[model samples]
Target: MIRTLIFLASLFFINICSAEESKPVTLNVIKTSITVDGKKSEVYDIVQDNGQEGYEGVKGQNFDVLLKNKTNVPVAIHWHGLILPNNQDGVAYITQLPIPPGKSQHYFFPLVQSGTYWMHSHYKLFEQQLMSAPLIINNPNDLYPNYKSITVMLQDFSFTSPDKIFANLKKSSKEKMASMHMDHDMNMSEPDLNDVDYDAFLANRHTLSKPEIIQVSARQKIRLRVINASAATNFWVNTGKLEGALIAVDGNNIKPIKNHKFQVAIAQRLDILLSIPNKKGTYPILAQVEGTKKQTGILLVTPDTKIVLPSKLATSDAPALNDDQERQIHPLNSVVTKPVTKTLHYTLEGNMSDYVWTINKEIWPHVTPLKISKGDQVEMVYTNNSGMSHPMHLHGHVFQVTRIDGKPITNGPLHDTILVMPHSSKTIVFNADNPGIWPMHCHVLYHMEAGMMTTTNYTNYPAPSFYTKMISPQK
Candidate 1:
């Protein structure tokens, strides 16, 4: 009888421990304001643990996200680059309904992978109001344990509302096409690189005029995680007077390469390692927007150094991005040779004349999903027929760029997002290990809002009831 009682006691203890492990992390989506360059502007931010700025967790742990909405409008949070379950992907209409105004929802998923990632509002235009933050997951065996780390989130801010800006862009594009005697059909011509001019660029929520200063000792090793969260801007990151080794892109580690400057497209991330000079002085790490004179950056200062803001950087023309650097990056682990079971071809089609973007000439509601079987090796070829670049991002999966323009890449780096250049083709390969419906779309905000999106689905897998009710059948 005593042994039976002890066994029951042990079972009770185990259940208690499980309950503790399954507790959720509460995050509040808030309406707030921050001062940039000495000017105040209203914005949105995510807060946790009594207003802590960001979220962090160790690898292999379960994350239950309780998103409390404090704003008056609906919002949903997308766990960018996280290979979580599809139900937690946070697309408003596709995954689940948007969190209504002043309401909350729970998103629970397991952290199956470890790396640098971020989260932002998936709702329309809310991410432009500064509704993003870093979502970093740490591995126990860190590669660079001795190096101090810093996160620089790059953004483009304007006083104008994002809706109005998009409307104006559509109007201007129509006018410009009419003046040039061009057809209104979007398929006839390519779109321009940038449509809207922003008022300011920011690094770590501060402008160049009021940059965030990092204190460091001379000869210290530093790891800088740079995230380009801009809605429509690409940036060329320059580490002034400091030679940096490019270690990772989009949170995936690669063989380190020495570089003075690198380009980061919208919704991308770059991890750079720098060995500070032995001499005591201040150095600026600048992110210059492509094609414009505007720039923003942060300063790394040593002891007894006076911080002096540098003048705005100048470029004669817009910087161009190439696959040369991307080609150099390879997976840290050797890829196993496997037979590809299926191949899919897609064309990115869009033009600024009508401000409508599509995948394979069909918008989201009318588009057909790319279907794959679980555990099958899949290869997808994206041919960018559009004029502007499209940084295509896939949810709940990481893919390797296996071919570019019909040539095979020996060992490419794994990424959740890849930028397909205008009129170029990119081929990516991945194993369909996770089963669910996932949205694949361009990371550019306006383009996505205009219908540059699609879904990947596992054959015969059932979607959630909420999704079925929310999204009407396209056919």
Candidate 2:
């Protein structure tokens, strides 16, 4: 019996190693450029060639981002929708060592989540400018409706350099973007409000001299995966001609909402399903941001007809967040407190003048410490006392948005990142199933680096392996 036990243990170890080795892997760091309106531009990229060596490989593959820097400028990448090591969570100076400019960095993980996930430079708000793509983790067990999948990565652009914008934001944090009097105690006059952003917007890296248009035939159900890849801008994604069922958000499935137009905030996503009717000629699909006249990507569906290039859609005056659309419901106490498991509340506090953003008024490298037992149900409240919007994200875990200012969001989907608007409060709950000193902070990469960040530690909560131990709940 002793000999048999030892043999079984050896076999198990060997199997685990081989399985990991068999997971196709490739990594290359290089410079790639895109010609924006006939002008050439270059950006860094960490590419992964999923070594399937066939058309199957083109289906999809997971990749890790390594910050290859020698100047120590702090390079990092966010996995977005991936489960990986705590150190490789990809927030520079937090998860692991930042990739200085002259040094080489690498992120190693698998892409198997399917649906719609993306990767981007997590260094400052530079993500607004570089290394964003449709990271599809093909579902081998796909049991849903079969359709041709099209991935769209939408972006806001600029003729102006990003460096200048960063400088201005650093210089002026209180550059107001329109404020109203929600209070009337006597000081209820029109508050300071100024709507302003630094750049133009694009869909799939192009603007509308000639925008990206999708092709379709009559009677076809197309899967439209849309990603908002901007640094700091919100958009109104609409179909000038085609209407769609809003199906998914941020890689998690949701109850579909039907609307001609809806808000798509920064770092947000939407997957729409549209069944094209058999109509002759072509129809244009348009997606435009509310504030900027610049927009990109319009789908063109034709029924046995030649494609006619669309004339530019007329521009509209920039619009502010309407009260009806920006309705922020508060938590309603429907959330029963999970029995003394674990909880952390960090008042998200920050300033923009010096470009320092923080959680509970403390920046990273020195963040609020949250020590949780493995498998503990964890609840966190992000009270944004600051004036700017922050997209809060927790590494290595997916949580439900349980409450907004104590109001319950009973049917919220599980997510890795939740955007908390300025001056609003949000509460999220998830099992601290993953064990590590994982970084939890604003998904706004720059904001996290500036301040708005925290940590959650799970010490030996008890699972068989490290990966399973961190992610899997132990009942």
Candidate 3:
């Protein structure tokens, strides 16, 4: 009887293993070739969606990400606007080492937020092309009478490689990396690229005329996830044929705002839900950058055979608010928004020519730590002292972008990355729910390597098991 029991138990365990193996799975791996621009190029690196669970409720979609280069370069990838484990945030030399060229760095993080958010390289100009689609996690519980979802990713491209662009900016001598929050002259080169292989702006790898359109049915709720994936450009999203309701920002729920079109700064994400009012054969969702050309990602759905379009997108492109509106919107909200409080502040500062960046004007020492209690509501402000835009971000946390230039978010949306325009400012507020000392810095990777890097601490929280997975372990 004992022998029979053992045999049955072993047989049952094997069957369970077989069943588990049969379940659907996804994977991200390093590959050498991927299709881009209708041609198969020798991609430097590729990441397959190792279809590991990316977030809490996200259904698996294996993203075959295109990494630029002949091979993996020493790169770091941090989901700047995500709540993730410390080891996966992709902070280099501190959390992990750089992923070398001609190679691929595979990363997975729980996609807890369902709205709009993005991913980018944590190193130099790599974000220009190497950065792929913004991973959108949809709410499984959200049966909001909508069957269609659209993703619009915005990006900045140059005729020349980013390597050439940076080198040229450096040669100009007048071009300097300003303090992280300081102001600098915004005089940019005329965007017209000569000898450009890809002279087009893209909304999901396609230009406006040849737009990326998605089809939705009439009278159905269509959720559009807008991601400003650009390295430099800020965008204004135009909703055509669909008058949308602003439902959420940065994957966080907010009171819906009634608006037709809105401005989205670099690195920010907006989630808009719209009802396809009767009559839509084919229409386009366009993203036009101020003072530049436009790109389109299409949503082509049919309840009828009528082509629907708004008279003019700019008809609804309200001018950005002046100082008065800023004040009315972002009222002086309380700092350390805690029923119980723990206070901390680091003054973001920088120098142009020196290319030196600082927190409270001091470069962060690799040995020290940033401190905070778990579950504390943390607020950080970037006061612009120079004349340039800096997209400031925090790892392992997504904060509420509350104010711009001390004004509150009255009607405007919130985002993970708030572009601090030259000499102006923005303040972000959020709860530090996860416990880890995470890095906080500029999303412009080169600026970070220069000096604009720092960390925040959640006291008494040990590092994650993934950190133990580091190949070149530190003592």
List the candidates' TM-scores in order: 0.91, 0.75, 0.70
Provide the global lDDT of candidate 1 against the true structure.
Answer: 0.84
What candidate 2 gets wrong by more than 4 Å, as runs, is: 1-23, 45-75, 98-112, 159-161, 174-196, 281-283, 290-294, 303-340, 352-355, 459-475
Weakest 10 consecutive residues of candidate 2 by summed lDDT? 51-60
User: Could you tell me how far off, in angstroms, the CA of residue 192 lies in candidate 3 after the best superposition?
Assistant: 15
Q: Give the TM-score of candidate 2.
A: 0.75
**lDDT against the true structure, each candidate:** 0.84, 0.60, 0.56
The regions of model 3 sitting more than 4 angstroms off are 1-71, 99-112, 143-145, 173-199, 293-343, 346-350, 354-359, 362-370, 401-415, 444-450, 459-475
Q: Mind giving the per-residue lDDT tens digits that candidate 3 earns over 1-475? A: 9999999999999999888644433323232433344444332222434532122226342222333223345666555566666766666655766667555445554456555666556655666654544656667776454456667776655555677755554443234334322564555332221112234456765554445556577676777778777666556677765677666666766666656666676676777787776765666677765544444455555755655542223333343312332232221222235543544554555554554555556554432445788767776777766444556777776655566777766434345555566567777776778777577765544445446667676788775544324322112
In angstroms, what RMSD does candidate 3 have relative to the true structure?
A: 7.9
Model 3: worst 10 consecutive residues (lDDT sum): 189-198
Residue 152 in model 2: lDDT: 66
lDDT per residue, candidate 2, 1-475, as tens digits?
A: 9999999999999999888756544433345666666666665455655521101222244453433442234566666656666666765544554565666655565554556766676656556555556565556665346766766667765555566665665555444321212333445233122223644456666665656666677777777777777666666676656677766666666666667665666676667776677775565555665544545565555655876765444467445333232232222222233653777887887654366776666666554366788768888888878666666767777677776767766545556666676678888787765576676767654465455666676775332243333232212
Model 1, 1-475: lDDT tens per residue? 9999999999999999998777777899988998876779999988896777668888888777788998888999998998887778898878888899889998877787776788988888999999998888777778877888888899999889999988987788778767666655545444556767888898988998888999999999998888898888888898989998888777778888788888888888888999899998998999988777678889999999988897665555546666877788887863335978999888998765687888888776677787999988988899998778889998888888899888998888788888898889999988898888888889888888887888888998887776656444455
